[model samples]
Target chain A: MTLSVALGPDTQEGTRTGTAEATDSLTAPDIPWNLVIWNDPVNLMSYVSYVFQSYFGYSESKANKLMMEVHRKGRSIVAHGSKEQVERHAVAMHGFGLWATVEKASGGPGGNSGKSGGPGQGKGKRG
Target chain B: MLQPEERAGQDPLAALIGLDMDVAEPTDRAVKRLLPNVVKDDGAASLEFRQLTERSLRETKIGALRAAALDLDKDEIVLTPEGAKHWSMALNDVRLVLAERLDIRDEEDAEHVHLMQDWSQAEDVESYLALVYNFATWLQESLVQAMLQSLETRR
Candidate 1:
């Protein structure tokens, strides 16, 4: 049977997590890590974009841009953070059933641009 | 499709405790798709990560599945934000398992499967699975579109 979209009340308070600020002081070299989302035939395009917006609190446009990149390029680094942070995001993505992997940002295919700001750090844009 | 492993004459407490003495990567392709390696090209590291996190991950997915199942009984299901999240996850997992069973390895395979829409055409197990997979995909797309609309309204 074809399922219809019947949305219930949207009453849950949107909990936007605070974006982690850039930290300059570090004793140990905290090389950046990336949370890469791979394209799959199973996951819906709209669902993937929604995940980016809701979970990372990215803006709609940014989420769509990244989602399109994943669809076209086969993969996209959706978020950047410290190794631990990106690992946590990877776990969350897996829970959503998206194919996600974590790797060092510097060595990955999309090499780090030295611009540390990325959606994975939860850049404070809601909706 | 997701069920707790049942071994005869084994301790039932193992499931409750959420610990297994020996855990290896799942042999089934469908199971592997659900719980994939987090790190690319690093078997040892991925295995270590799986050992640390796979149990909790299984529990989380199961929890979502159970919640979605309960809502299925309602005459007109009205979901809260949390309920929608669970439903989305459950439906997505279901689709992943179906896709694997259908052997939909690429876009071409998915397109071929999409051709099996009519119930009358389902003469084999493979065709039946394809229809089910397509249904789940359509349902997920609708839910996601609703979610995106809500997000827009919130902005």
Candidate 2:
């Protein structure tokens, strides 16, 4: 699939003093964000795999592998890209009724090391 | 319930949601697919999720499908913003169910249906299910596109 790689608007420039500046040199763009799909009781496995294939243009085996990862691991990083792209992917996943979220790639800025909530975070209907 | 002739006046969403019980209650494979486990490897959590949300999810899907089946007799379907959202969700639910029944796991499974020469030669159940699966996929894709278009216009 064609990925849109425009520079993300919400790039946070990390500022540090002394030794801290030497260690934390990761740029916002370098710290990729992930679009995650959480396991849900409603969506079918095949359907989830199909979405991964159709939306991301993943090969059938890759899509199936990712679907299985979500099924087994409770969540999977379905895409890695700029925050804007990741957020867009999350929205599309939500449009398909899958539980989705966007988060700073593990060990990114703000030290928020886990999946952060996106627009459609809750377990309910789309607004 | 309206007679076949009176269905033109009936709400399209209602008509879709009011599918005969037999049509709604698909085989075990479809049922398992429609209601998949949320917490894998944790039987208790999976059961809990099912206990808490299965009925409500089913009810919500049925409600949305009913709302989407609004004006079946009309040649063109024009949905309000709210109707479009409901239609999208309902169509996804229908496609999920149909895909499961057809045993469509990957591109290969989908290709089998696409490559069929004639449904007349297939078993009655297989042919009927293939038709339903294809129809549901078309409807779901159309609704998703419409919803995306609506989103673009609002932005």
Candidate 3:
């Protein structure tokens, strides 16, 4: 499913700025989207880690770290790549019943610049 | 909770529906986990969202669970795309409820569940719930794999 949501004008502008910032990064400019999973009361910590490992093929320790980050910080950027790839990850996470979203790799409101904010901040959306 | 022979019988679907009904009834822990507040800081908006969506969401899940149970009773257990989605969500709901009831909060708790030997050796409520939790997890994992396989074929 192509999950789309309408954003306010200001939010849209912010997303553009964030996308630009992501593109300007030195290490890699092609990967400008992130797949983020948010913390929720329903999913178990271990289960989340297991999903990360099984789906993404991350090492156990790395999956555990990402799961812990989501648990402690309310969200974690699980993957970063092009829009299509990130959306695929988001959809897979949703298939596992995780609250996931694809957002531009830029910062979001509430002082959550691209690096810190949870998944849906750029679009203020969900999948 | 089901034996190998029993799993092949029609009773499995009935048992699954029974379990779904039990889960659908209001229980404090289940309710909190299944219909968690989306907006944490705003009490008013949270309450409003729950009131508006909770009932429908619960009903949808229940319906899906029941449908999946019926589907399992068929000769082939084939799942349509919509059935796949519903079954996945229903299986997740079951896991979430089982996890909450079992107090599976973190890695240690989940590891303890994994360490359990057998349901026949279950000495207490926690042990019994651990078995259920593990079974639900297995079920969900299998369904997820099946869904992924189908996605791969479509691609």
DockQ of each: 0.34, 0.10, 0.09
Q: Which parts of model 3 are misplaced by more than 4 Å?
A: A1-37, A40-74, A77-127, B1-27
lDDT of 2 by residue, B73-146 (tens): 56997778777767766767676566666676655576676454455766788777776656555555555555
Q: Could you say which candidate leads in DockQ?
A: 1
Off by over 4 Å in 2: A1-75, A78-127, B1-27, B73-76, B117-123
Error of 1 at B50 (Å): 0.8
Q: What DockQ class does candidate 3 belong to?
A: incorrect
**DockQ-sorted candidate list, best first:** 1, 2, 3
- In candidate 3, the residue pairs with backbone N, CA or C atoms under 3 Å apart (3 or more residues apart, or in different chains) clash, namely A106-A114, A107-A113, A107-A114
lDDT (tens digit, per residue) of candidate 1 on B38-85: 888877666766755677788889999999999999999999988999
lDDT of 3 by residue, A1-127 (tens): 0000211011122223244543444235455676777776446454565477668976555566667667767887777776657655654564456777555666422122334445444332222
What shift in Å separates residue A101 of candidate 3 from its native position after superposition?
11
lDDT values of the candidates? 0.76, 0.54, 0.57
Model 2, residue B53: displacement in angstroms? Answer: 2.3
TM-score of chain B of each: 0.87, 0.68, 0.73
Q: Model 1 off-target regions past 4 Å?
A: A1-31, A113-127, B1-21
